[model samples]
Target: MDIKQLKFLIALDETRHFGQAATRCHITQPTLSMRLRNLEEELGLPLVRRGQRFEGFTAEGERILAWARSLMAAHDGLYAEASACRGQLVGTLRLGLVPLGGFEPMRLLSLFRRQHPNLRFQLFALSSEQILEGLTRNQLDLGLSYLDRLAREQFDSLELADTRMGLLYDQRHFSFTQTSLNWEQLGSLPLGLLSSGMHFRQSIDHAFRSRGLIAQPLLESDSVHNLLQAVSAGLCCAVMPLNGGLEVGNPHLRLLPIAEAHTLAPLGLILRRSAPRSALAEACFEEARRALADELRLSADR
Candidate 1:
């Protein structure tokens, strides 16, 4: 019936127990129960399925919970905007980033922090698919991931980096005179790569297939750092982008460019096409765009 009741519903969903949800809302169990009953009566629909324990929400309850979440999100967004107009930004920005984006997300966050010191951020390392789903579900305000990885989703994206996959290895362990490598040559190396479930790995696999070669990774991990560590320890060579990676400035690991790699894709910032963009989200997006432009400029200079 009211935001208070909606808050109670969210707490109930989270705790899945009447007593615990009531405690979280700082209300008595019976009062919480009464409020829930009133809410169901107002809606003229059976929301909660009551039993010996806190049964899960009924079909209508689930639908109401979805709207509750969205209403709460927009409500928070409005308050944040109001604060921003008063010359302060105070809110938690939920950001989902693919591991491939590396520290770019952090770097972007760092830049935003300089301007809006009061705003906090919650960053999640996710796959491109997960990022897309998170955006649709209103779980994430923004995402840093491959623009092309998402299919059948309405998304607005700003390309953040022109990243390319390359061979990462300690130069001391390899015999490569040239900086760029041919795709066919990768078939002979003991490689450390991402798992097949990851879009990054899928892109690499597709590239190998196009070259009539099968990628046989000696070490497969979902974490980019794991693959990088494998390469660092001279365990195997890794194919990946050097941007925002630990090896970028490391003297020992040489990022051998894949001269004609098809695995490389434009990494970017994405928002749900129809979702409302908060002021903080817009500010961060602009900062990200600036950072990407600087990166591209530096790459050109190099």
Candidate 2:
């Protein structure tokens, strides 16, 4: 019945382990279980399906959990609106970011903080699909993901400039005279690419397939950092974004654009379409717009 009890339930759903959920709520396992029990008694419904360990929620529990998430969102929004009225916005905005190396979310965060110094952020590195699901479930306030992947009807988006892709390699392992290399030219190189299921990897696969080619990666991983590390060790080259934290003066590495890549990856900030928008979400969107404008200005000047 109480918000605290609802929080415990939500935590349990997130962690899927009683002890971990208890730890997240800064309470002991016994207390968390007792509180949840009290909540179930108050509601007169069996919420949890329990045995020796935490199993799962009941059918009724899932319905209640959806309302619980909505209530929690409204509760946070209430506080945020009140703070905004007093000339400052405050609350922890949950942001889900699709994993893309060198995307540099901190740049946007830094800009956001300059205006709303009291506002905080909780960033999660999630896939584009995960981000969409989180937004729909009220588990996330904002998300940075691929614009092309988001449905316009479900969410409002602020699209940024396309992020270009390239081949990353150590200078000692590969030599190239041109500034860019075509996909056909990459066939013979031992490559480290993103794993099959990842969005980035899917894009790479589609591009290769469209050209009547198939990539044979020597190393495949979900983490962009891991792929970069493999390239650093001269174990293999990698396909990466040009802006993905490449060291400018590092003589050992070079990032050459994929010449035949016609469709660059589009990046954007997305917020779920809901009645009475959260003040925190709106503020975050405005800040993102400002940051993009600044970036455009800087690029135009050059």
Candidate 3:
């Protein structure tokens, strides 16, 4: 009946343990149990299916939990709006981004912050899969990642651009005639790429396989920065999106476009389709759209 009780229900569902849920809410075990019992009595139905401890929610409890999440999301949105009316939007905007997203998020965050200076941001460099997962759990407000691999039913996305892959290498270690190379050409060269666990690596593998080739890299790293560093030290060449931060400007470093492997991966902003987004989120999403369009235009002019 109350938002506090609804929060308790959501905590229990998220943790799947009574003691932990109570601990999260900073309440005693008996008090948490008694409060839930009181809630059930008021609603005239059992919420949790109990055994010795917390098992799971009943059918009705599951339905209520769904509503609880939606309501909680809306409540947060309302608070943001109220704050906005007072001349500032004060809240944390969490972002989960694939390493390939590069400096685009900073651009978006800067534009948004100019208008709402009080809004704070937290950025996490995550894999494409982790970004989508965080959106579902309400842990992330938005994601800058590859949209091709995400399920259509679960997320709403904006395709920012077709991020063409690039070869970042040091001329001291490997010499190439052309400024741009092909996928088949990469198989023959010493390479360091993202680990296979990342979706970006999977996309690279798929591109190689489609051309009757296999990915044989000299080094594998989960962090994009590490892979780029390996290439910088003349250890190997790295294959990644032609975005900012990856191509270190140096006489020895070369940022070459990958040819025939014209497999263009879509990079975008993704958010949960079912959840109620905050006002700050809505405004930032619009800013992201504009920023992407401007970037595309600049790329075209180049």
Highest lDDT: which candidate?
2
Q: Estimate each model's TM-score.
A: 0.76, 0.92, 0.72
Q: Sort the candidates on lDDT, descending order.
A: 2, 1, 3
Candidate 2, pairs of clashing residues: none
**How much does each candidate deviate from the true structure in C-alpha RMSD?**
4.6, 2.2, 4.9
Clashes of each: 0, 0, 0
Which ranges in model 2 have alpha carbons more than 4 Å from their true place?
246-251, 262-265, 294-302
Model 1 residue 28 CA deviation (Å) reads 13
Whole-model lDDT, model 1: 0.81
lDDT of 2: 0.85
| Candidate 2 structure quality by residue, lDDT tens digits, 81-111 | 9999999999998999876533667877887
Model 3 residue 123 CA deviation (Å) reads: 1.0
Per-residue error at 145 for model 2, in Å? Answer: 0.7
Q: Which 10-residue window of candidate 1 scores lowest in summed lDDT?
A: 99-108
- Write one digit per residue (lDDT tens) for candidate 1, span 1-302: 68999889988986999999999999999999999999999999999999988989999999998888778778778988898899888899889988765335667788888878988988888988888987876768898888776653587788766666778889778779876888899999999988887767887898898879999989999887788778878899988765657576678987777876644577878877665657677767777777778888998999
lDDT of 3 by residue, 1-302 (tens): 78888888888987899999999999987888888998899988899999998989999987777777778878888999898788778888878988765335677788888877888998898988888877886767888888777898988788865666788888788877887888878888888988886767877888898899999999999887788779878888888777655555567787888875433367888877775877767767877777778888998999
Stretches of candidate 3 off by over 4 Å are: 1-72, 150-154, 249-252, 262-264, 290-302
